[model samples]
Target chain A: MLVRGVTGMARVVPETRDEILAAAARRFAVSGYRGTSLQDIAGEVGCSKAAVLYHFANKDAILTELMAPAIGMLQALDERIAAHSGAAAQRVAGEGFVDLAVRFRREIALLRGEFPELLQQPAFAHIQRISERLIEALAGHPERPAARIAALVVLAGISEACGEFADIPDEELRPALLALVRRALEPVD
Target chain B: MLVRGVTGMARVVPETRDEILAAAARRFAVSGYRGTSLQDIAGEVGCSKAAVLYHFANKDAILTELMAPAIGMLQALDERIAAHSGAAAQRVAGEGFVDLAVRFRREIALLRGEFPELLQQPAFAHIQRISERLIEALAGHPERPAARIAALVVLAGISEACGEFADIPDEELRPALLALVRRALEPVD
Candidate 1:
């Protein structure tokens, strides 16, 4: 019985960490990272501040881990997008980007200005290359300044809209989002 | 000579106040409200902390004043958008919204997650109504959830992109942005 209980307790440890991440994400989304407090997250998780700190060294540690998956997925996207060029690349990126944004709506929301000096941070430095490549792949016309702006809007807009209208059922929201993206990336007149 | 010196000092007061507001906006946009401090603003303005406080009570006060013009413009956009219905309304709002966003790009950047509990603030409460109406006007097909999502993406996307690509000249950026908005609002296939 003692050994069985130890195993169950071990399982609960990971579960508790997941719960803390969820709580932190919600608070950061709704209150902004500045507005959220360690105690606030602990309170939501039904844990002590000390316990929360034990799982994650600090708020920044929690943020780094919480956002790792999104950043990793962006890397995966960069590779897939690398296979194609011009229109083919844009098509793959646009569809993949939309799906990624929807799948990680909350994570994307956290990206907008969550770290304005994002490139300066050692943890977030690689984002510059991945995002630049992604934008390059998605841009409608590489030479024109306006074309680049449109791509920025489409990608940034989709990420933000995911969180803004998160409650909208995925089946209903995905197509509309994709349709808008297609229009933005259509050949310029 | 005493009166002339006094007059010069009075003019300098407003200039100092303006300086403070400008410094705060840059700091807030970069480091975020939570990351920035009164001392940081003062340091930027080449003024003392006491001087910054004298001009504004605290960080929130400065935020309110600096964002007042942006909010006021949003209110104005609401009136212009109210004049039309359906596509016409979307056109007016889309163009007007993009223009407003560009004109106040930094302020719009500050809006994203700058205040997650924005509606709760008494000063910013009216934004709830204005933004809802603006999104309603910009949405492609009112009957579908997707259209609403599109509108949200367009408006939010423009605001964020304005800050992200602030370097692109207005003449080059404007038409391209408007073109994207028009495509997003086009009749469904």
Candidate 2:
């Protein structure tokens, strides 16, 4: 019984860590990193700061981990866009982008809430590269760099609208938002 | 000679403050508020933190002040769009919106980067309201709500391209960006 209990307790460790991450993301998103404390995260997780530290070396580590899903989702969406063919591909890619935008509010808000200085950090270089690559891929018209610009604008537009103005109902907003992006990607006269 | 020196020094004060603000905006745009220190700003100004603070109360105050021109510029853009009259209002608005997007790199970046959460704070309610009103006025497409969404999307699109992706060169990149916004604002088929 003791060995069984130990195994069970071990399983809960990862779960607890995830709980801490979730709590931290929420806190960091709503309250800027400076405004939040490990103690606050501990309180939210019903654990000690030591335990939180065991999961993450520090606040920055936790934040970087919390933001992983957002980055991953964006990359995955790009892959999905590449895989899909025809109108279905466009719709799927657009929806995935929209879904990520709507759901990744905390991560997006946290990033936007911080300064661009975050971009200069070597740790975030992957994100920049990914963003640039995504733009390059999305710009089907190499002749008109506007397509690339439009892609970025659409990407940023969705992120801002979803993150800051989430109070607006998604059902009412998604179609219009998607329509706007579609228009943005279209050729100019 | 003494009176002349006093007048020259007095003129220098505002000029110095403007220079400081410019430096702060550049640093803050690149490094963010937490990453930046008064010493950094002071060093750039060839002074000390005490001297920096003499010009502004604190980093928060500096941030708030940094927003003044951004707010004014957006407000002015709003006025320009609202007052635009004639057959090509949509087309003209698209061009004007793109112009604002290119020029608003620092302002949009600062707002989206450092002040996103500040939107929820009671103190920044006025600022929030101003942006909201501006967005509403810009996107007031009488034909449909999609127009409104498109307007917000265009603003957001530019923000994403310029604010976060600061590495992109302007001369080579802006035409594409402007084209994207122009397409986004065009009447839907």
Candidate 3:
């Protein structure tokens, strides 16, 4: 199959669903979910819109596919954190959250600024629940306002770091981000 | 003039453009920019869509007006911070950024998750520039990658705190957010 590379040159490649998803994810990250259209994705993928629809039911389907891996990983981390207690759980939650943010930086960047619109779609409902669980774990399941606020700041801080430092290779960004999160989560003397 | 209170009961009062903007701001903050329509604003204000259109040219107009004050205040803060040097500038930027977030908590909530969409609208162009300046100020105008990353984290942390803790009166949230920013900005000694 022929695909248009970033240089606009025609190159032979396998026409696979992953290619379509990669194109969609790139477009969504750059243009935003609301700003991107299925046609746009198809254009980027060098396929017909109907061909794109053949693999995914709709744009929401594409988004669901794009985020499913990250969501699954988060849910698994949520369960693991739940199985722990105190500082252990907070540590697990913090590390897991940052790892996921680093791994899925593009998806995070795409959704971070478009959360309100994402919430309105049924496909993204699990995000809120997963995020709340992560926060709860990060706060060590505490009911105190300070812990909750701290957890939120850490989460937001990591997310924003990942999004803004997208050009930085993950290996370099991951430790830097984890260090920041650790400092932010430290108890105030 | 009549307006609909939060209880859905009609209250007789003088209808004014401020009322429409207030209603639109509330709706946008709660439901999001794309989720809201002029009719929704009109319904909230107990006025007609025509009345809303009479005051504002379009939805973007309402959003522009809603954010103008915050933008102006941020620009002023930017100028003030620009006059300072090194740690002094960073300190001023941190406090001013958090103060602005606390003061315009509702507006922050409305815009926090809608940045990509806002960028598409020409009315919000200055937000990008102001945000860059704030980030630079927060970094003490440093050229280091770590400093830049730290500044981004501080800004995002305070914003997320304000948006999530909107119900916690500004007086209470201000100190907590400032404390978080201060800690996040500390050097990694």
User: Which candidate comes out best when scored by DockQ?
Assistant: 1
Candidate 2 docking class: medium
Provide the clashing-pair count of each candidate structure: 0, 3, 0
Residue-wise C-alpha lDDT for candidate 1, range B126-181, written one tens digit per residue: 88888889888887466768788778888777876667756876777778888888
- Which predicted model would earn the best lDDT? 1
If candidate 1 were superposed on the true structure by all CA atoms, what would the RMSD be?
4.1
Query: Ignoring the other chain, what TM-score does chain B have in each prediction?
Result: 0.85, 0.64, 0.84
Q: Please list the residue runs of candidate 1 whose C-alpha ends up more than 4 Å from where it truly belongs after superposition.
A: A1-14, A115-119, A186-189, B1-14, B186-189
Which predicted model would earn the best TM-score? 3
Q: Which lDDT tens digits does candidate 3 get at residues B106-152?
A: 77777766675676677777778878888887766457666677778
- Name the TM-score of candidate 3: 0.88
TM-score (all chains, Cα) for each model? 0.87, 0.71, 0.88
Per-residue alpha-carbon lDDT of candidate 3 for residues A100-144, written as tens digits (9 for 90 to 100):
888888777767666656765777677678788788777664576
TM-score of 1: 0.87
Q: Which has the higher TM-score value, candidate number 2 or candidate number 3?
A: 3
Pairs in clash, predicted candidate 3? none
Return the lDDT, model 1, position A174. Answer: 71
- Report the TM-score for the A-chain of model 1: 0.84
Alpha carbon lDDT at B20, candidate 3 = 93
